[model samples]
Target: MYLNQHEIKSLLNKSFDNFVDFVNTLPDIRFTASPYGKWSAGQQLDHLTKSIRPISSALGFPKVTLRYFGISQRPSRSFDQLVTDYQRVLNGGFKTTRAYMPGVIYPSQRPALLQNFLLQKNKLTVKLLGWSEKDLDKYRLPHPLLGKITVREMLYYIAHHNEHHLAKLKDQELQGYTWQNQLQQLIF
Candidate 1:
């Protein structure tokens, strides 16, 4: 339900670790593979990196300055509530905006991609930890799709957002996978 900073950080760290593990399972060639006109697995990873790094900087902005941007803070939402709301947004066809898109070119090296993902996640976790408990429920930022949410909800969203992308990646490949085949291929 309500997420304290330690619980939030632990959730993010676990989610990131799970994601990196998933990334390692994909064949190197699949990194660049995509349906006719879509982002490759590599590009999806880069897109996530692009999306989260800016939030780290956004967190650094003084509260008064953020308020000046006209994004008013809302009451903090529960973690479970955010997960449910996020799923609705996903099913509602919320798309990543053009500005958040990664460049067409992507790193071919799997290790490099993993490293980059881990680094950005670490940066985000550090930023999240730097906040006081009151700040978590006080400060707010404009989420591209969801608009203004408190810092706690934003962290909750970040954990779920990464899971969403990985699900999308799996969906793109599920066309060819039987349940057993998928189990054999997906290492968890």
Candidate 2:
């Protein structure tokens, strides 16, 4: 479904807040625990924060600057189309680069990570507010995974992204139960 800027803003605010609360609720050990050698909860948050920096910078840029960067003049895709496009990229095996991965931050640094997350998230929200919905629909912003997209699409991702990560974290939370559950399934 499509979300206007206001709807997107609300969802983004709620999702990020909820995600942070979820992280805070985790046991100390869960911060660093890699359920299956995949990203730990902390690493996932770190990656998301890093991923947002470029978008924040882009949001700060003037339209002229975007022009210099050769912002796409392609037709603005609908919000759902933008999300579907990103999903396709993931299904196509688009992995985040190593530089974007978490390092030297985990259980011991949870506070720092959470603080940074708030800082970056705040910047993104403010920058987004600077644009009109039409402006958001008109200008193209480069996304690390989604390539060039209208600002509206960017916000769409911003709105939905944390929920995606939150689901992953929940799966990780349940990771230790898998083996026991499997045994029960077999016994049944």
Candidate 3:
């Protein structure tokens, strides 16, 4: 779906805010624990900050410079389609590149990382508001995993990506939810 600037802004704020709130409620140990050897919540937040920083910075570039990445000739994918495409890639075992990885986000780094995440998110929103609805569809950005996607699609991904990580964090809680419960649900 083609999201207008207003819709984009609202989704962006909602996703980031929800993630931050959830993280804030975590005790320091839980925040930094790597459940089932997956990334800790702190690492996930750091990764999100790293991923979003580039998009926010790129959006500040002049339109002409932004077009250096090339403009899209086709329509932007609906938000749902983009999310599905991302899921498909993930299911295909397309791992994140080192560039976007967060090595070791210590508990002490949590505040800085969260602050940076908010900064990037706010900058992206402001930059997006500066754009015309037409330009959003006209411009393209290079997505590391999805190749070139329209600006609007990038924004859609940003909104969903935040939620994606939150879900991963929640999934950790289910690790010890008990085999009996898992089997009962499957049997039912």
Best by lDDT: 3
As for lDDT, the candidate ahead, 1 or 3, is 3
Task: State the lDDT of candidate 2 residue by residue for 1-188, as single tens digits.
Answer: 76777787787788889889999998766776666667778888898888777877888987778765454566567767876888898899888787787774557889988998888788888887888877776788777787677877887787677778898898877765788535643553
- Which pairs, if any, clash in model 2? none
| Per-candidate TM-score against the hidden true structure | 0.83, 0.86, 0.91
Model 2 earns a TM-score of: 0.86
Point out where model 1 deviates above 4 Å: 36-38, 69-74, 105-109, 177-188
Q: In what order do the candidates fall by TM-score, top score first?
A: 3, 2, 1
Which candidate's TM-score is highest?
Answer: 3
Alpha carbon lDDT of each predicted model: 0.76, 0.77, 0.87
